[model samples]
Each structure stands twice: as structure tokens, then as C-alpha cells.
Target: MHESLFSYINQNAASPLTSDEEALIMASFQPKKYRKKQYFLQEGDVCKYVGFIVKGAMRQYSVDDKGAEHIVNLFLENWWVSDRESAVMLTPSRYNIDTWEDTELLVATVADMVDLIGKIPLFGQMTRLMDQRSFIASQRRLNSTISNTADKRYEEFADNHPKFIQRFPQHIIASYLGITKDTLSRVRKQAMKK
Candidate 1:
């Protein structure tokens, strides 16, 4: 259960927190369950909490004026999900987050994060590192989308997340890849044949 979170924290965060600091952060965190199709954060709403998935899948997406959904990110077991724009700016979100499956999450409110940084400065360093890592990953994604071919995108995605290929449905994979379902099917077939 929380062993995953502990491992994640230990991996990303160095310099252990003081007992008081750890307790404060833990106090503000509460576990919540979301069912399939549930909306965690809708576009235009302020995101109040950052969540770590205990189990299940969630997608952060944007919808165009034409009512098309473009997946910006996908999170599954042991992943964190948040509307980064709103979280960083403390403003309404442009992304909508929803459960792609029944999900269990450990949620830490924004207030707690502020307090954590104030009490445990090392946590701040940990957070900065995580943010930088996320930025680099996003930049790589943009590069892949713009500079790489569609087949390359599929190959890269598969290489990065073999578990996702087996866990997520094909349609969702297509959404994450910025491709049509049919194209994803073909690309996957070609990749497997090779």
C-alpha cells in the first residue's frame, strides 16, 4: 500500500525530514477513491491537491473548442497526477483530469505542501528536482512529436512504458500517442511483427 509511496519518496527525496515535518505532511494527506470516469479536476477549476496514485489509471487532458480530447499525460499505479499549470500558478487549471479506471489516491493539499517546504527545506530541493525531471521528460515528448515520425513515437512510447502497452486500452494509448486508433493498431502490429 503506502510502501510504494515510501519507496518513491526515498528514491526522489534525499536528506530525511524531521519528525515534525513528516507528521505535518502526513496529517494533511488523506486517501480517496475515484471510480472509473470520475472527474478529478475539470478545466477552469483551481487544483487544490496533488495526488499520488495508489492504484488505477488517470489521464490529464485538454479539450479543444471543437470538443476533441487531447491527452497531455497518463498516470497509473505509483504515479503522481496534478494540473501543473494551476498548481504552479495558483490559478484555475487548463487541464481536465479524470479517472481512466477505478483509482485509489493519496492526496496532499496545497496548504500542506507550503508548510512542508517551510518546515523541511530539503523537501523543497526534492520538489525542485522532481519538477526539473518532469520538464526534461516533457521536452523530450515535444521533440519526439515534432521531430520523430509517428512510428518512432510508438516505438519510443513502448520503450519507455512496456507496462502501459499491456495495461491500458488501445484507444487510450492512441490518445496518449496523438494518433488515431486505427493508426495505433497498425503501428503496434508493425512493431510487434518486427
Candidate 2:
């Protein structure tokens, strides 16, 4: 169950963890499971824990005044899911996070994570790398949404995240691309022809 987390840490950390470090890190997280459609977080609630997904998928989204959900992010195996702002600031989150399928997570509270960061040098390094990558990904997505054409966006997304295409629904993919479902259908059909 902790294999993926250890693998991620080993891949990202400046150095591999010692067995003692691994044991300490493992002790910090608690395993939990969520049924499909269960809430990890709700809008207006404070996000208390940052969860590392062990298996399955989750999504973070917000409902507009019109009551339509706009997905902001998706999570899968080896991904970390949380409203960082809410967790750090102890404020209500604007987004709702929920399981898309039966999901397993290893979760740690902000305090526990802070303690781990202080105690584990490699863990800190791994987390810093994760933060940097997350920021870069967010910037790229923002730029793509602003500058790319709908078709270009879908093509790029499909090429970059083929797993998402297989795992998520078309409507969710369309939302993530900031395009309408019909536009996504047209783009997909056009791609099929090409």
C-alpha cells in the first residue's frame, strides 16, 4: 500500500530514504478509503488533510452561481490531493474535492506533514520538488487555456495525458480543457479523421 508513495519519494527525493526514515514517514500517514462519489472536501469547509492517492481517482471542482460544476483539477494514483491554501491558511476551500471512483489514500494532517518535513531531509526535498512541478503544471495549463485554440488544447491534453482520456468521461475532459462538450466531440471527430 505504501509502495507507490515510497516510489514517488525515491524518484523525486535528493537521495533515497534510509529504512528508519521510511518507517518514520510511513508512520506519519494514515490510510483511508472512500467510496465512489464520497466527499473528500466540501466547498466552504476547511481542508484538514493532504492525501496521497494510493489507488483510484478524485476530482476538485467548484459550482458556479448557475449551479454548473467547473472542474479545476483531477487526481489519480501517486498524486497528492488537497486545497493547499485552505490547509495552510485554515480557511474554507472554494473547491469541492470528491472521489470519482472507490479510492485509497494515505493522508496526513498539516501538522504531521510539517513535523515530517522537519525530521526527514529527503522527504522535504521530495515535497519541494512536487510543489515546483505543481506550480509549473498550473502555469502551463493557464497559458494553454489563454493562448491555445480549442483543438490544439485537446490535442495537447490527449497527447500529454492519454491516461486521463481513458479514465475520465468526455464531459469532464471537455471541462478541464475549458471547452464545451460539443466542441470536444467535434475536435475528437476531427482528430479521428486525421
Candidate 3:
């Protein structure tokens, strides 16, 4: 339940929250559910809400001109996901975020977030930390994409996420790695035989 979210908040918060503060913060969030493959945000639509996953998995991706899908990121339980640019600027999103499995989420509209920040300073601090971590992850992904070979990238991904290969479909992982499914298969096979 939402106690999971409170636990996550405690772990990331600048300091422990008072009961009143926790209640105020929690009031802004609404629980939502999506069936497997449901779209949370689709390309060309404005992102209306940012979600914290309570359970299940999701993927953020875009389809290229050639119709190939490129995964931007994968989100699992306890993770937060949003099309930040669209959410902040009120612009159409270029990416799509969809459920990979039936998902339960705690969602906050931008207005709710604004209210929470104004009412609870701890929420503001938590959001700042979230933003910083997101930026660092983006930088690391960019570096790996530009400087690493396919094999090296796969190795790093596999090393960092030892269980993802088992949890998600291979094609999804291949798309995330910026590699072809066949290439991923070959690399994994080679890795196994080593």
C-alpha cells in the first residue's frame, strides 16, 4: 500500500517527517492502476501527472522515423517516472510511457506538487534530491552511449542490473541497450559460454 511510499520518502527525505507533514504530503497523491501495456503518457500528449510506482514495471520509449522503438528508461516498483519536460513546460511529450505489467501507482499532478512544495519544505528537499539523481543517471547513460562499444555497454548493463535480464523481456532490454535483439542474443550467448 501507500506505506511503501512513506518508507521511500523516509529513506530519501532530508529529515524525518512529522505526522501532520506526512499527512499533508500524502494527501496530494492519488492512487492509480494500469493494466499491462496500458499507456500512461503517449507521444504528442502533455504529461499530466508524475507517478511513483507502488508495484509492477513500466517502460518509457519513443518510436523513430523508421518505426523502430528506442527505450528511454525502465521503471520498477518504488521508482518515480515522468516526462519531465512536458510536465514542467506544458508541452507535448516526444516519448511514451507504458505499463509492462499491471501497475499500481501513487500519482501527483503538477498542481498538487506545487501545493506540496509550498506546504511542506521536506517535500521540496526530496524533489531536489530526485532531480539530482535523475540528472546524474542521464549523464551516465549519455556517456555510455557515446563512449562504449555494444559489448561493453551490454556488459555494464548486465553488471549493474543483474536481475533485469530475467525480469524483463529480451527485446525490451535490447531496445534499452540501443542494440538489435539479435545482437543482444549473440552477446548474451557469448557471455554465457565464456
For residues 1-194, write the lDDT of model 2, one tens digit per residue: 88788888999977888899889878989899999999999999999898999999999999999998899998889999999999999999999999999999999888889999999998899889989999999999999999999999999998988888888999999988999999999999999999
What digit string (tens of lDDT, one per residue) describes model 3 on residues 44-152?
A: 9999898999999999999999999999999898899899999989999999999999999999898898888888888888888998998998898899999998888
For lDDT, candidate 2 versus 3, the one ahead is: 2
Query: What is the alpha-carbon lDDT of model 3 when measured against the actual structure?
Result: 0.90
Residue 36 local lDDT, model 1: 93
What candidate 3 gets wrong by more than 4 Å, as runs, is none
TM per model?
Answer: 0.92, 0.97, 0.95
Which sequence of candidate numbers ranks them by TM-score, best first? 2, 3, 1
TM-score of candidate 2 against the unseen true structure: 0.97
- Model 1 TM: 0.92
Report lDDT per candidate: 0.84, 0.92, 0.90
